[model samples]
Target chain A: MVRLSLAMILCLLMVTSGCGKAPSESSSKIKSQDPASVQNKGTIGFSALTLTNPFFKVIADNMQEEAAKHGYELIVLSAERDVKKQADHVDEFLVKGVSAIILNPCDSNGIGPAIKKANDKGVPVFTNDIKYDGDEGKVVCHVATDNYQGGKLAGEAMVKLLGDSGGKVAILHFPQAESCQLRVKGFHEIVNAHNGKTKNAKIEVVATLDGGGVRDEGFKGTKDVIESNPDLAAIFAINDPSALGARAALEAAGKADQVTIIAFDGQQIGKQAILEGKILCDPIQFPDQIGKVTIEQIIKYFNGDDVKTEILIPSKLHYKEDAEKDPLLKG
Target chain B: MIFMLLLLVILFSVLTVKQQHPTGANAGDQVGKTILAQYGKGARVLVVTRDTEEDRGFAQAAIDRLKAAGADVLGQVNGSAIDARKTIESILAEGQTIDAIAANDVTAKWTVYDRFPSVGSAKCVTPKPYMWPNFLKLSNLMSVANQTAIYAIIAIGMTMVIITAGIDLSVGSLVALASVSSAIFIRDYCGGTEASVTMVVLGAFVGIGICAAAGAFNGLMVTAFQIPPFIVTLGMMMMASGLSFRLAEGRSIPELPSAFFWLGRGQTFGLPNPVLLMIVLYLLAHFVMSRMVFGRYIYSIGGNEEAARLSGVPVKRVLLAVYMICGALAGLGGIMLTSQLSAGDPKFGLMYELEVIAAVVVGGTSLMGGQGKIFGTLIGAFIIAVIKNGMNLTDVDPFNQKIVLGAVLTAAVLIDRLKRHA
Candidate 1:
């Protein structure tokens, strides 16, 4: 009887809560928004993979700035690299009746459902930094770095450093990410082409290790590679953290001066590494531009204008010589 | 029981706060029309969050805005993402159509792709296979089994410790230390080459040996100094974790031989080796706990320590032996985990002790000691694994998943208490 009564009360409570407020009270609160001064522009939501990553944070800030300029209220949420959390953020946006949503997908495939939900709701969705695996038409646009181009630039720089007498090289990479895979593809293709044409210039990839895209994994993987391949001439790290890890391992082995290191992601540490001559050069991405472009696409969508489906923001090469001159290298 | 009732009341109040005072009847239609103007008349919004005061506030605000916008506010669910999805499923089961859902981005993404299959692109890409059908697949079953197997192995020892009215909080840390030590030994002495049968066995022994030594040290400290088991084990936990970190030098040891992985990831006759090993260990634990004299002594000691001592039971020796056995099991668990990940990370087995302990407790082991079953602990481990697998398959929000898990555990204990009283 006690359990039954408790359950009954719970049911009653749930029903009452579901239909608690009348239309007049909520409508009155809604009228508080002055229709005269403020343009009733729709709200735009952004779901970032994580704000802890300075790159993503910069993009989010830029998107906010761009949204304000377009007279739209921006709502930013961080997924903290969890796909489930990102999905929830999208749901929240849909509930708030946001005009559009910008996503930095934690996983391309995992974001399919969220994109589908927005598509059904007629709320345009845009992806920044990563592409979602849903229907092509579902997403209004994808704003991201041209990672393949960045890799090509890195490879070209390596060729210049090698000076047509290329030696054995080690590649530290995170193979799981599509962006990283593209970077590796570009780097490998360029190096292979260079080797095939140039006599006496053979850039043999002695080892390819998975750095798991983190400093600790990079450090450990590099240490293992260095132990196995002491004759390594150069190391190409897919990102700044991996390069830093390799640098630490090389320093520990007292062979830091022997190998030329090139990395992607012109992070603060990587730039310092370049200035310190530890790293040859880094390919830096324009995250702020990506964020601004994402919002621009959303505005275009709202204006019933055709928005390009894909936008590749080019990455720049940051060298030790340019560190002092280029504000981009200031991290 | 009182605490359980109080918690339920608090949960009820929090859930019903918005419903306590309904707005004017005419206000509902006005707000609904407003929502229709913004979105559409057919728009249905479902709001969800983890059951917390703060999350509820967010849900309420969204509900208010949704109401103001003239949207058909379906309801607010304060539970796991899986629970929210289940609610949607039930609503759909009753033939009620849902148009939209509101949640934090993570939960929203997972629920939409996982639950509302008709609307989204059919192809849902996830790092791990999360389809509901996949949960029943042999490979996924094996994956779940593999996870449960490790926890069950560790929980076997934890059950023993709890049976004696003692706790071993350092088992997780011990697993890390053992794994790191074995990895280092294998790399240095065995050439870190492809796993041969001999190398795998040698590595296992080395890892288990290190864990046993650590366990012995814990036992000696607890028995010799007459220190509380909690304090002793807690100290051991930190010391073992520090040792693991120091040995690995803040890096993971990867590239273990294929033979080593065979113990973790390998299948024999469609069953993972780890699952097989877990079953064998459980059988052994069952025998030791139910049929052996040592087990009887442990029970007596826990039931009445003074009486057991007066009855000439070598309490110190038995306690020491029990701890060593627990350590050995933890060592074995570590070796298997290392083989599974193909890496011995110092950060491996982080907070795993809590899970193992929870498994033991949920299996009906009393903290005050004196009663428990190895089979029950095994079931407890599987329960946890199943919950996790189900949540993943259903695309439950990870944060909300934690809440659901906590609630289930509490309810389990409460049910056990009610049974005791009845």
Candidate 2:
């Protein structure tokens, strides 16, 4: 028991350390373009939806690191998750004379005016994570993972674990993130397609719960699902943290083996769970890579290079066997 | 109180006509030049100013800046006497495209500010005009409801305790702890099948029960140890926060049941449920404080604790109940917050106690232990919310929002103080 606890602590420390240095090292490797060689003379301003979310932090950190390596400064501002604040931030960036801007907009529509302003400024803008409802010419690029595809894979994994017999499966979700909505769509579609996959595995997508993406919420959300669905076959979480929390509740109630758990976001803890055979599988997203891609596109645009408007970064689907093989999850 | 209201009316009147100028976005020669990057020879600008050489020179300076930047100065409004309606009407009569409007040396009043006709596709920028209706709006009202509900829940209970000459510093931290606990429960039980709702209710009750126990513990500390309620609750606040973090491992709980979400998101007849809950609670509190004999005991205790005890009031029991009630309300707030976010996070509602205290004090509740009303607190919350929401609509920066909240809080308190003196 002592050895196991020590192993877990060491693993968590390694993950934390890896997170801190990956960006700075990655950016340092990218050769800095000479200012004299700067045929692409323009600024790129990167504004995030909020600085509060650690998810956004990982993306922003990577973008800044890569941009710095390319000898370009990424003007970063936190909109604090307010749509209006994001709009104002965009407008301010526009007024500052940027060549192009990368926006992780807080709202789908509130950012339209700022987009227009940037358009008027003759600076190309790219959106990440969120899709904007505006003219294609107004935006230069939109890069994001196929959240729906990832969610479908999660559903498939759940069905495989539960078999052709259908049972109740509760989903812990976030309403604010459109990505979650896409995931829900995919999960429902995939589950419906798999008839008789289990003897009685009639997939009931229970309440679309909002965990607000917090741990205590994860715990509470999982506990609620379990209590509400006594015969629940499996739980599908939007993210790994929620999955870990659900695991905690299941352990507490001594129902650990009875219910299968599947989740999105191949976070470190989720990887640990998969390796231990506690969870079915987790679909991993490369947020840092997404950030790097966005930065690269901005740099390319500044260099008079035409880049694709949409960039799709692939997700890694990891089962227990795959997770155990990964060096990041190795002892 | 009457004098304060009278002064507000007077202040409102004086502030309205005292200063008038287009402070918000209005296209002018300067704005046109900035936007166009070169003054258009045929561009129109509406300049609002006093009919004096100095005022005209300022307007001209702006015009020159615009022209140099690339815009034509087309029109001007020289009002020697300030009349918002008449002033705006005169500007429209000029037949110039209102490219940008700039207010010079004028206080913006709410009544005259709202009278400006459609800006006609021109960008308008001006100092925010203070309007009563804008101050009392839906968005602003919602923000106030959120901010006020955070503080008022605890404050109402604190008022009852303080009226009995007791203090509860722990109420703040207790609120945080309870919120964290509730957040944890709701996050776990929120998305399940039919039982999810039942699970969430159970979690809420358990979380509240934990808070009530914390309150009861406070009562026991004071009663058993003969310790001051102030010291006891203050100590509890620190310990509670520590316990919450230990339980949560510094993680925030996010997911929660939709039913609880309704507490934060639900609206009846265009008002947020949290605000509606606050009103209902306030009314209930008012009734309990004014109509019940317990209310009389509380006031008597505040006026003279020893005398109330001598007069046959169960002073110790009342004190304990008061603290317990305060704790429970704090727990209720935590639960409501859980509903709002649909998550249980131990770290949630941290430092919210201060805001609650501020609302209580600002609501004309005497911190000296007795004088206050639930209705006054509701108004206090409104005032804070108006400043925040109004600032948001006017495009004030977030940092500025804090400064504005501080200023409004101070002003409200000052107004109350003045009333006392008057």
Off by over 4 Å in 2: A1-331, B1-143, B186-194, B407-422
Model 2 TM-score (2 dp): 0.45
Best by TM-score: 1
Per-candidate DockQ vs. reference? 0.03, 0.02
Q: Which candidate is the best by DockQ?
A: 1
Best by lDDT: 1
Residue-wise lDDT of candidate 2 within B299-326, one digit each (tens)? 8777777888898988778777877888
| Per-model TM-score versus the true fold | 0.49, 0.45
Under CAPRI classification, how is model 2 graded?
A: incorrect
Model 2 reproduces a share of the real contacts of 0.00
Could you give me the TM-score of model 1 versus the true structure? 0.49
* Residue B2 of model 2, lDDT score: 30
Residue-wise C-alpha lDDT for candidate 1, range A122-191, written one tens digit per residue:
5677898888763423787899999999999888888887857779898998986889999999898889
List RMSD in Å for every model shown: 15.2, 16.8
